[model samples]
Target: MVAVGAMGVAPAAEPNTQVPAGSRHYAASDFPDRIVASPAQDAATGFAVAWRTSTLSAPPLLELALAGDSPDMGRLRQITANSRILQSENGTSQHHRADIDGLQPDTLYAYRVQGQGTWSAWNHFRTAGAAGQPLTLLYFGDTQNKNLSHVSRVIRQGWQTAPDARLALFAGDLVSGGDGMDDSEWGEWFAAGGWLLPGMAVAPAAGNHEYFEEFEDTPQERRVLGGHWPVSFALPGNGAVATANTTYWFDYQGVRVAVLDGTSALDLGTAQAQAQWLDGVLADNQQPWSIVVVHQPLYPLRAERDTSVLATQIRPVLQRHHVDLVLQGHDHTYGRRADDNAALPQYISSVAGPKQYRLSPQARATMEPVAEDTQLFQVLHIDGKQLRYEARTATGRLYDAFQISRDGKGRKQFTELREGRIAPRDCPRPVSPKGRDDRCWE
Candidate 1:
């Protein structure tokens, strides 16, 4: 049995593996379901692609083409030859994914996926505007542990708050068990966010949870996890942990969004042994705004306070890069910490699910009741030189708002929202409050 720790396992010949030449097969026409866009194909071009397949043999041979304005298939622009691959897992039926490349920047492109007997209705996505253009992105935190109940709230409320986010970044923890062996959780996550998926790109970071799940007790765990990962979403091959498909970099108009997988940092060390790789990547920057995201938060909230190792090891690299913004999860609550070099980095953490956590007083003005307990999420809008950030509650109410402008040039300056509504006192405390026991179950 392989140890269920970090998922850095090397592929080897296994006698017991049940990989058939082509086992489960689904006609795309029968179950025309999920179609996702990921892994920007070109780091320098406006080309991006997504994949879709049936539930059987599930995914189809990827057939791509340059889409025209008209939804009419015959009235299209260009169509590439059929490109396809099959990724099977745990026996739960799912189609693998593919990405389209060599696209025109700032243009709308339509695409569709096909399988055994089904073909998805054509969906459209607008390529990111050229660099320096104002843009919007939706940021979400750990949908870990439970999804059926908690995740639905986050996704629904997020859709309510900002339905037009060009992209949605799930800062890791897509599933628990440290892995995708938990087929139920994975299915629940996809089910919960099914509404907005076809229109939005789910850029995921592999959290520690993606590495967990039952190996033998459940058939889902027996053959899924890693196989499903690559097939699920087509991400940019810019990240170094492995290929551009795994840990990669991308550009969104004026800002350059860099995504790293911290869960793979300590384990996939040699993959990034090439010196100056990150430096060259960041130094060769041309965008006005730069933001980086990963699974572990550089600035953890109250419920999570153990980052001595991560801080000591990765902190220096972040500082040297002068990276503009960093998005993360795993702490489970919303927090903002700034002031790098002195002690902790200026960062903000938020909980996206209803299964919440209590906050502490490691930082002043951050004790429970002083912060927030409501399911949280954030929407960032970059317009010209002014960048605006808004934090909202589950009911679509504003919690915090700030607009940062170009004054420091390299340093960030904040301008408080004079009219934005901010909430107060709705969270748990470090020391249990009266009447309620320190632990639940009373």
Candidate 2:
């Protein structure tokens, strides 16, 4: 396990412990969970892609083809792409990816891999266009523990309900990483989503659980999660840890999504380093919607207002650049503080996992976009100059919804502010699953 300081990481390990019926042979031809799409390097013309393979081998190299049977694509020429190999720590195996470039703006493309002498079934993804336009994206709080058991149900439900969802963002604490690679936890994380992640665009923000313990001699921080994240999903490579390869940023359609490592920024001595880079990234990237993702919420659900560490550190930069949205997870409850800035703003804090999520008495009394121990996700629809954001639980219930419309450059408006709170709820209090405890959920 790699040490992530205060933040926890989801450890990667072999299935020696958690295979159903102990079927290790099934590893062949099987793909691990955390499969999702990310925008490739070229903000204007490319999108990067990655997915996990059960048995390790050389990375899959291949070209792309649009999967849909649209008349427009029939006449379009097929594009060739290059694939790269990545290794996972669970075992030296293949984590495949292709940087599909030269794609048409706002157009959809499908692709497959050619490696180990086998051609993978064609997979599909969409590209983002340049310029000012309202855009849509998906946000999930945390999928850390209870991955397949509950997380799978939540993710599949979200996909089933919103098939058109172009992208998915995570708030972190995605898996409950124990002292080392707890095979059961990692397996649950992947099995939860099964193959759904590959079909949707998945963008992740590093939660503490996403880190792993690495040896002290190792310079790149933790290697546990380092082994899992790279090939599990394909992401653009313009982030803070350019040389390290973990933190990076990308642009989708007209939104510039910058993923910052909160765990590092807080204690890794990368504060000044990343802060400097962020200043430039925010200043240089001029996308219509600027979104930042990190594990710890700047506006914590239960922390003291003045003591909220991250908010004090990054909120100024966000306000200065007029960032449109800030997404986060950690405090395991649903919360939203609209227009938080002294002037105007939109801040949201939510959770999507099944562990340690609860609504405090104080939190419940305040009301205001509150839900207890709820598995929820946010769906936003952007068209032209309008942005509509809705918060919904895993059961497909609309808990809270609102709209923030922009007229043009530097113009903002708020609409339909829903007041009140969802009934309070809590996860079964933590208890050893090995022993009978009411807190443990079977």
lDDT of 2 at 215: 73
Evaluate model 2: give its lDDT: 0.63
Q: How well does candidate 2 match the true structure in TM-score terms?
A: 0.79
Considering every candidate listed, which one attains the maximal TM-score?
Answer: 2
TM-score of each: 0.76, 0.79
The per-residue C-alpha lDDT of model 2 at residue 440 equals 25
lDDT of 2 by residue, 250-348 (tens): 777667777877776665556556666777778987665677887776756664422245666677777887777777777777776654644235667
Candidate 2 error regions (>4 Å)? 1-35, 41-44, 54-59, 68-90, 130-134, 179-188, 214-225, 242-244, 302-308, 360-367, 419-442
RMSD of 2: 7.5
lDDT tens per residue, model 1, 1-442: 6435466763332211122334332222345454666536343244334444334542354444446655555634433323344433434344554556666666666666665576666766777766666677788877765566566776787787777777787887776643323444555566677656766655777766664344757655432235446555666655564434446677676776767666555444422431234555677777666676777766566544665545556556557766656777766666665545531234666667644555555633642222445676778888557678777777778876667775546456666674767656345434322333231101
The CA lDDT at 258 in model 1 is: 69
Per-model lDDT: 0.58, 0.63
Per-model RMSD to reference:
9.9, 7.5
